[model samples]
Target: MSEDDRTRAMRSPGDGRPLPQRPADGLRSGGAPAHRMPGGGPGAPTHQLPNAAPQGPPESGPKPGGSRVYGRERSGSSPIKPLRSRREPSESGPPSPRGPGRRISGRTVLKIVAGVLVVLLVTVVGLFFWVNSRLAGIDGVLADYEGRPADTPGTNWLLVGSDSRKGLTAAQRKKLATGQAAGQRTDSMMLLHIPEGSDKPTLVSLPRDSAVTIPGKGRDKLNSAYALGGPKLLVRTVESVTGVYVDHYMEIGFAGFVDIVDAVGGVEINVRQAVDDPKAGLKLKKGTQVLSGSQALGYVRTRKGGALPDFERTKRQRQFLSAVVKKAASPGVLINPFTAIPLASSATAAVEVDSGTGAFDMLSLGLAMGDSPVTTVVPFGGNEAVPSGGTAVKWDRMKALALFDALKNDKPVPKDVIDAG
Candidate 1:
């Protein structure tokens, strides 16, 4: 084509529109060469070109249509704002409200419960040790002797209540009506037999004034053996007469008896008749009633109720002891910290056990006693006068032997022997 025709084709007809400028690199602003309109004449369709680049070095900014140009801004266009990432919260606005806290998993809850149980177990074990250490022990009280009875099928415990004012003050002694005695004497004695089989335990009361042959001394009142030689001779005398071995020995004095009863919050007893014994400091009406420590001590010590005072007293002793032990071992007291702690402290401190017996043995004793054992006094023939000892009760040899043999063989006592007692 002729140069004049090419030049005319690039320009617009008669209306005089401005011509597009070339960039510094000799190309159009869009980096493409200009193309001519298809029908090269006036009034024909033409391709529109972008505006020329601004003066000065090409702008490091957005182009005319608000499009980003190399991550820069243009003077007459709104700059393209970078997109906000999800991870980056907006700093210009107020803070968002907090949602609910994360929930704890079931596994975490189990772990917390297990931790609490471990703490409770540790605390219980510590308490057991502390209470066990408080039990009072007696040396050689159950020492083996050459002629001591052999081990029987059942466990035997010799429980002794002594008229000892060792720890009582003047006022206490006066209040308890326990005369000032120079030496300790037996107030009550009982043999508790716990069979290995499911049979219930048996508790037999031995009258203090019964005539029995002491080891070295001849025939005398049963309590005379204790006064002659301490617990050793007394154990020997009882064993020789009963022919049943004594496995454990426990003793409590008058003051200790009171403390134990009071510690357990008192014991309930059904009195058979009215009794007012000034000598024993006991006064009560007939019926069921709760007895405090001081009142319990007197109730068990009094020999003033039935025709046979000593027998009635023994019955009273057994009744009161069983009630108190049951209460002490009951869940209502054991599960309660207030009652359990004081009962443990007072009972352990007050009672004295043989060297071989531990806190567990004592606990077993309480549990066995609380089982409502068959209670009865030793079978007695009648009262008798001895040469050295004053008037004393005599045991019926035949019935007594049957009862002890039953205990030795771990068999139930003969019904006739139980009835005789």
Candidate 2:
């Protein structure tokens, strides 16, 4: 088409219409594109463009159509900002109420501690009552005796290890080498004297074969009194001989002794010399060794192959007794209910105490013995054949009296007396 014709066609339509003004910069004031209707380019009728977005100041909050304008205007294309997991506030602003975290209170902590202590207290008390209930009570065993010596300054207990096979079966008797002795006999006897003050407790071993006058049987082996009249006659004879009051009598038998040793796992003893005695079923090397129930019984009972049979036997008895007391009081036994409960049950069942010896008395005696006692045998003059044909132990009169006097008055025995026995 000719230039004059094209120009006339493009310009002739809006030659008389007013055009809208544009901004100096390309960007619109509100950061949105300035828009207009499709056919109203030059405002041919001067009507506002239909469906046009608002063009307000860039600092205004938001567009009227719910769209946001960022702080700085974009140059070309819009790039997306990564979303944060949580919104961050101004640097100097207060913390959010839901952000600080939880804390435990002092009152809750105290309640927890109190609950723990109450549980422990109940456990301990229940154990105490359970142990108390297991103690066996012996009554009327000493009631028949009369004219006993009056109470002395300190306590004296007659602790006897008897050779009574009351609970032993034939197999057990053979295993223990405890011969089939028809009746109960005192295998070991000890005068355990606990002095009134801080002086150490003294344990004096009395030979079962000691020649002593039985209350009505005249002179005989000391053990005969128990065989004849039981605990009463035995206590009477002991009181008359020592001149020390026998306040309590506690006797343990063969089977029970073994049970106790086993229940506590075993007793540890230091043997000075190698011992191999078939009669007592003991075969041990000389050293610090742990003896089981059967082995411990044999260790305490063996008298064979010794130059001084009864004397050496009594010494072994004292050593074994001390070992037993120490083992029983140890944490391995006392703290473990598996051991302590069975031990207490077996011991109480096998032991026979005097009528007056209560659970408290037994407890005191056991505790006292837990402390190492000074062990000695009664001073012996000689071991010779008696009129009855068996050997009988003869006590040194002067030394024996001195020992008894010291024990009765709660005084220390002379070194000579302690050394002589």
Using TM-score as the measure, which candidate wins?
Answer: 2
Clash pairs, candidate 2, are none
lDDT of 1 by residue, 1-421 (tens): 9995676666645675634333323333334443446555543434434654322223354456654545544345655677888656567764444424346779999999999899878877777788678877778877888988898998999999989898899999999999888899899999999999999999999999999889889888999888999887888889999999999999889888888888878888888888899999999999999999999999999999688989888898988888988899888888788888888888887888877887778889989988999988899977888878579999999889999999999999988988888
For lDDT, the strongest prediction is: 1
- For each candidate in the order shown, give its overall lDDT on alpha carbons: 0.83, 0.80
* Residue pairs in clash, model 1: 61-73, 62-74
* Deviation in Å, model 2, residue 64 alpha carbon: 20
lDDT of 2 by residue, 49-143 (tens): 45545433345554343433355434344554645457565356566656663455799899999998998788757766665566554666555
Q: State model 1's lDDT.
A: 0.83
Model 2 deviation from the true structure expressed as Cα RMSD, one decimal place: 9.2
Each prediction's RMSD to truth: 13.2, 9.2
Query: Which sections of candidate 2 miss by over 4 Å?
Result: 1-134, 144-146, 384-387
**Residue 90 displacement in candidate 2 (angstroms):** 18
Judged by lDDT against the true structure, how good is candidate 2? 0.80
